[model samples]
Target: MDSHTKSKDSAVCHEICQSHKNKVIKFFCTNHEFLGCKDCIALNHRKCQIDHIEDKCAGIGDSEEYKTTLIELEQKIKAVDAVIKKATLQDKEVDSTYDHVIKEIVKFRKEINDRLDQLQKQILADAEKKKPEDKETVKKVLERCTDLSSDIKNFKSKLQENKTSQQDGQLYIMIKQAKSKLNMDDLKNAEECLEQTDTLCTFERNKELENILTTHNAFGMLKPFATPMTPGKKSVSVKLTDKGEINIKTQSDRNGCQITDCAELSSTKLLLADYNNCKLKVVDTQIKAVVEEKALNSAPWCIAVLPEDKIAVTVPDKKKILVMAIAGKFSIIRRIPVKGDCRGITYRQDHLYVLCLGSKCVLTVDTHGKVKNIISLKNEIFVNPYYVLLSEDARYFYISNQGSESVVVVTLQGDISAVYKHKDLSAPLGMMMLDDGSLLVCCYCNNTIHHTSGDLNEGQTILDSGLQNPWAIYYNHQDQEVYIGGYCNQLKIRKVASTV
Candidate 1:
């Protein structure tokens, strides 16, 4: 027998090795089957029963054979790496899809706004034109009636002098006949004149306006929503109402992100921060339109607008705040590098207070980007401060901290007065003071808008649902509409229930 041959009666070597081999071992057969170890082929060896070792071996060895195995493994690793890279590219594709959807929705809104604006001007012109026609009709009738009255008075005076002459009688009969003809014409023109009466006037007829209000479906706009518009299998429809429990006029997909900030300029105009998309979208309320949108170079964490139409946005990633005009033009007015993550920003008079997402300090800056004051509240409870709003008098600022789940009322002099807390308060992103001194808080997690009286008590829910992630809430005094912004399956603008 060869030196490598094993006897048939030899006992199996089952002894544990001194050390486990560092290099992996593999085996293959003539049938093209492969396995990791000699142990896997023990049955095949038993069936062969020849006990031939080197002669029957397929030439698998520990030198170039092992090296070849390693090369195969490296190729497999490369294939797996390619797969991982493809997955990463897929994530970017998802992001781009969301971005495109958001842009399309915004574009739709702009078209609606433009159409509504043109329609509003047209309505005004129509009223102006109809006004003259109606006025002329009224003037003609009034003049004819006046003449009839004067003629009757003269006929009565003539009759009093003596027996009425044939000519006087004829004239009296003719005047009476003329009056009858005028009455007949007035009867024929009643409906047209009434229709013209309304068109000639500029008064807003709630019912008439409601009838003429364009009918729109929010389904298409909400197609890109991050969440199911309807929570369950039940069909959901958002409709416009004159004065109902909920008035849902506009909706747009947030493109799968939640809203972070919202500000209402009028009943027909709003400013929104599409946080995930790094975009600032402007919407029209009256026509449910998007007027303009600007893409931020970095993430737009917060936005504030001045009375002069200038806008300021803070980007945490960029570590700087940008100032831009409403025209979407950036101006190098002020560049603020915050010490921590800048979360919230608001303008009061000539000063700006920035809320830090990482610190408890409120940064105050002037119009020239000069650091004017830093208000530090000694409260250790607040870990992350989000949104800040100033009182109408500019004497106090309200800061909502997500970490503490509390809203802190602070003075311009760095004085703390009150702390409002609710069991449900999670991340209060947006806070607004209503005209009647009520406060509207955007509870992000709950997807609801909470309303509270001046003292922060008697909390009532104005809107409870239909929002994916409401980040901001703004009230437009001109149109009496509330604007909500943040992630909602997509970016969206909705008209709040308002009396005006």
Candidate 2:
């Protein structure tokens, strides 16, 4: 027998289970499609109902089911042979089709080349016809310059002769005449003649040709087709209430200071960074009192709440980030030295994202102050990235650019994705991402808080009236409240809710 036939018969006679060691598959588990010896059946298929392999294969060879399978196999083989024959014919026809398409493409290319050459010749001819006229205009201006030089020289010679002859009246008359001839207005006119106008020819695109080349139907009727999108769930409407302002009472040492940054510790507690006073104070939101106060070495510009009762603060001028442990009181854990001045800071997982002002980049560092990555923005997107807020998924980051008066969204890899700017969002300073994939932006110059989508593209005025230089914002998910802090001594709290 041939090797192929022998190999097929050997495979059919071989045992399915190698673990059985040539012990033929005597049992079959109907539910699990398992074939094994008595040992495998007891170990793994104990709970399953098994059948004898001989009983299952006894009449399969001569049964009507076997004849039906043979007929189906023959039909499939015939179908495959037909497909192979059709493919061979198609292969032969492909060469003719390719040649026909090449001929059409070459014909079209030649037509376009001839038309472009004709247009070029015509344009060159028009420019050549206008060259003499343009030259004559410049020549007249040069002649005027020569005439002005001659008149000035003649006046100088006449004045010298009068002075040599001791003719006082003539000399005076000559000087006066020269002064009148050299009037300021006339001199300015001469100077204007010296200014040259551009005479170089430039090409302007032909609108007809541009439309023929760029339109959707330029070469043929190119119809756009796309799969229709299924309707999605409707977004829930949000209801915002003006909850008025909360007067944040500071201690005697830190009284009436600008709150630059605020972070929610709990439902009724908040961490406020006293920028001007160079202090970080934890305040009780319910009673509007200071719970604890800590004095720092430098002015704290921004604060970020860390894991546990810890918090990180950015002191820009000091060029370092101070991580403090907050329990009953604030205690310094360690200071992370950075390359540039640190401004805004936020902690996620075990890493801290610090916005460096001097370098114009965001530094990602661990708790031990090891720098992992630096995300720098493109010049066009961000002139000044003041604050950085990472999305929940950590796929994108939103930055408020105070210099550009825009909020920019960038990927984690530092590529600019989108830029959001509105007339109301002037000098956007601080931002907070909401649970519903929206953002709350603090507009310092306009004294307004605007709400935007997660991408920072769509926005509208959420709070406009009772704000004064709103610099920082924080959202309390447990209490469903938003805290706004800025130049004013008071921290405003607003209740927010979502409707269907």
Best by lDDT: 2
lDDT of 2 by residue, 1-500 (tens): 69867655544434657677856667889889888888889889998989876556654778998999999999999999977864664454355345545665676778788988998899898988778877776787778778888899999999999899999999999999899888746556645654554567688988988888988766653232210111231223465687767666565555457788888787788889888778887778888777777888778988888888888888887888898888877889998898997888888767899888779888989988999889886566678788988766555678899887888866556756567888888889988866776788899988888887664546777778788899988888877888888888788888877755
Local distance difference test, each candidate: 0.63, 0.77
TM-score of each: 0.47, 0.52
Q: Write the per-residue lDDT of candidate 1 for residues 1-500, one digit (tens) a residue.
A: 75335532232233332233442323334443433235544545434323223333334455686789999999999999977865665465466456656766777778778987898899888877888987887776666667666866765665554344557776667667656655665544554555565433446656754754555754254443311111232211222122221222234433455457776554556677777767777765556656666666777877787767687888888767777767445454667687778878998656678877666678898766788788885578676778888766455677877878777777555655557788767677788876655577888888777665545544555676666667777766655456666655333434544432
Candidate 1 residues lying further than 4 Å off, grouped into runs, are 1-255, 265-267, 328-333, 489-500
TM-score, prediction 1: 0.47
How well does candidate 1 match the true structure, expressed as C-alpha RMSD?
23.4
lDDT of 1 at 8: 28
Q: Model 2: which residue pairs collide?
A: none
